[model samples]
Target: MTDEPNEIDGDLYEHHHIVVDAGQDLLRIDKFLMDRLPNVTRNKVQAGIKDGFVKVNGAEVKPNYKVHPMDEISVMLPEPPRDEELVPEDIPLDIVLEDDHLLIVNKPAGMVVHPAYQNWSGTLVNALAFHFQNLPEMKGNDGRPGLVHRIDKDTSGLLVIAKTERAMNGLAKQFFDHSIERTYYALVWGVPEEPSGTVYVNVGRSLKDRRVTMAFPDGDFGKHAVTHFELIEDLRYVSLLKCNLETGRTHQIRAHMRWIGHPLFNDTTYGGSEIVKGTVFTKYKQFVQNCFKMMPRQALHAKTLGFIHPVTKKKIFADSELPEDFSSVLEKWRHYIDHTD
Candidate 1:
């Protein structure tokens, strides 16, 4: 007996309602709304559940709440406020290789891979959406298209994207099976005692800071992470190490390097000392100061990526050159070496 309009005009001052029936029996709250409202997205549905806008039987419900044979489900969808929609930007891309099945691009730093809350435009997805005619849909609840894996927003590297559904499924399986060989180059603070070693640690959610992950000796919910590193070049004070990821975890390279006492330079989250000290301080004192001032993010980059092509079955290898900022740091360090020696 509600007089709510089926649809409202304007972007704001709008509301709607959806009734439940036996057909929706046992459907999760979020899934039910997605089916009922074609315009509403899964993320929007989840946000409504989090904001307590979704109620069942006159009670606020969780996202996983199952519907009965006969239930009253009320969903209040707030109109998006006035804002410019996603405008496709014709940004230049560094495409390494391309085929009908997949495309490999060298992602640059300072570019977001995909859009999320607050960041709706100017992402890699936006660029791809503009460039490509058809992009494969992502698996699971995340609605991003063609993105099988991800790198940090500030960390630049190589990324592989699928162009078709078959390619997406095959590539996603490669990531989960740890078949994708990814090698990263990092300029850490100090040299490790061993030239090459493996770090095996359990990475879990950080209890102190929810935003970061922490290593745990024994924890309830933790995943096994392994990183193998070899010292590629020793620049007197700083060591340039090449890391191969055995198991990909969130911030695995950054966290493991910090745990071993040689954090990457300018890594704020992993306790990289803003000021250089000890051997590094005395060796490249002036150069260290200049680096700390100029470099905004950690010195980490996915230098190499290798895998078997999902469709072609041919081995594919792609590499990215060191960014200008990282190369400049090495140049200063080389100058200090010459002066000190």
Candidate 2:
């Protein structure tokens, strides 16, 4: 990955272009893209086609138009809106590494990375704003203090905060170039077929539920996302997995793993809280429920992160230990699987 800008900007939208592979067969443009674009929907694509946001060979086409090999395609998608004001609060921060240019924080689960809507306080951004009163602001940031990226509120992990505009822009370019390395540890519902493999798919918000993300394996609709995962331990019904992200889309690992039929353990949104693999005996069910009570959130942790230091021109890596809730649940599963078998 190189440090070049990824998006081609228009007046109000971003442009995407693709050329049909030489060996590609005749397929509906909507169908072809439904399986390709990340976090997109068929309806969204069809709407784009109707509104002339999508074009084939420099001409706008309908949703049912057949795409042939070597066809040039382009689409214009609206840019994300600017964020709202950021209010500084006195939330505590678990500072891992801090210097003049940037700081890496070990964020705990259940803390929102930034303040939004009803989450107007107690966020990591609020903490940063309180601590760094004179932090530089990025363009179109509204009032976001020093954020270059974010993690899910329920996913605990390491996050890098930039203190200067040069650092922020440089780090953003690195992410756009896909040069950042992030690894996560997850307790999943079932063991993967292979000890290690990659889930290459498109990820997008579900049409049915906009709150959660979905994966498209047949190239339906979504942003491109890839997760390379390795099995660490098998606990009969569930397993431990280390997932490495190639593209950091929203809910990439969670949606990709769910697409592969192995949702993270205790992840209620993806059907991991239920007994997915164990027997139907009453004792087994009770044991599973007990495990859920022990760790109420999805069993995931951003264990490691690596990136190029913007100031030093050197590589920097940060690793975090699993929180008590996640590790304790793993121990319980190990004990239950061992004793019951």
Candidate 3:
């Protein structure tokens, strides 16, 4: 509701101290500050915590430190001359479904879900902000509003966005309860050993590599994730698979598939090499290279989403078509299958 800039930047430094109230007890230090200081980033807050700029009870604490009621909280804020924040771009959107409470969009590849370091502009949130003009504010940070779920930056697909606080709360609850259905179409390097199967794995932050997520077992730092996949079509070397998300986690589909030894084609982040020599895809190597050259991201897309409407209580379903680059790759795969098989 407030048009406050989500981030502040510059050289003005100021130190402030405040007493925590009873209602704020057990709140994470960074999260509490993120709520109070609308313009500061979570990274900045964590940095301050690490540099001992944030203190509790006169002692320096980590960002995840929980604050109790009546504790004294102190922070040193650097006032950066604020630049124009997150200017909305005139990016065209594909609205698959829209109602007073929610909007389902076919998000194209190459668009970031929200703003972050080095990506403060040209995000889907910025475009929504510009187009909607009066989106309801979420309870969390000021950066993103009404964002109930997210899709990967390079993975194009259907994304459901809430328009009202009630709707947001309800939709978030549904997702947390695993009541919503999300299906994706992915083109991978090979067919699985089984025709259909479930990948039950724990996905957690990779301690060695922050950019990549890994699937591990119980008691690890990762959360439990389940993906049900069925083989839709096989192209000898590559296969088309339909994936259903039972529990959504960061890179759930990609990481789960990679963990099961079926890394997506051309997904370099998860150990997939480009179509090279000596594989069944030798004949279409040039075509694959051209498609990868033109495609900005991966060949994954959220194809369908189904949920009960928060207000209407009616079952709703939305679907998105594959982008042109993915379609072209599938076309080549079909051609290869026809000739070879």
RMSD of each: 6.7, 8.5, 5.2
Q: Which residue ranges in model 1 land beyond 4 Å of their true spot?
A: 1-57, 60-87, 276-286
State every prediction's TM-score relative to the real structure: 0.76, 0.75, 0.78
Which ranges in model 3 have alpha carbons more than 4 Å from their true place? Answer: 1-86, 276-287
Candidate 1 lDDT by residue in tens digits, 259-335:
88888888888876465334555545656777876667888899999999999899999988998888887777777
Model 2 alpha-carbon drift over 4 Å, by segment: 1-84
lDDT of 2 by residue, 1-341 (tens): 01122344454343457788889999999878876664467788788899887788878899999999899887765654334457778888998888889999999989998776567788998899988977776775646778888898989989999999888998988988989999999999988889999988999978676668998887888888989999999887899999999899999988988889999988888888778897989998898888888788898999898999998998999999999989998999888877875
- Top model by lDDT, which number? 2
Consecutive 10-residue window with the lowest summed lDDT within model 1:
5-14
lDDT of each: 0.77, 0.84, 0.79
What lDDT tens digits, residue by residue, belong to model 3 across residues 176-200?
8999999999988788889899999
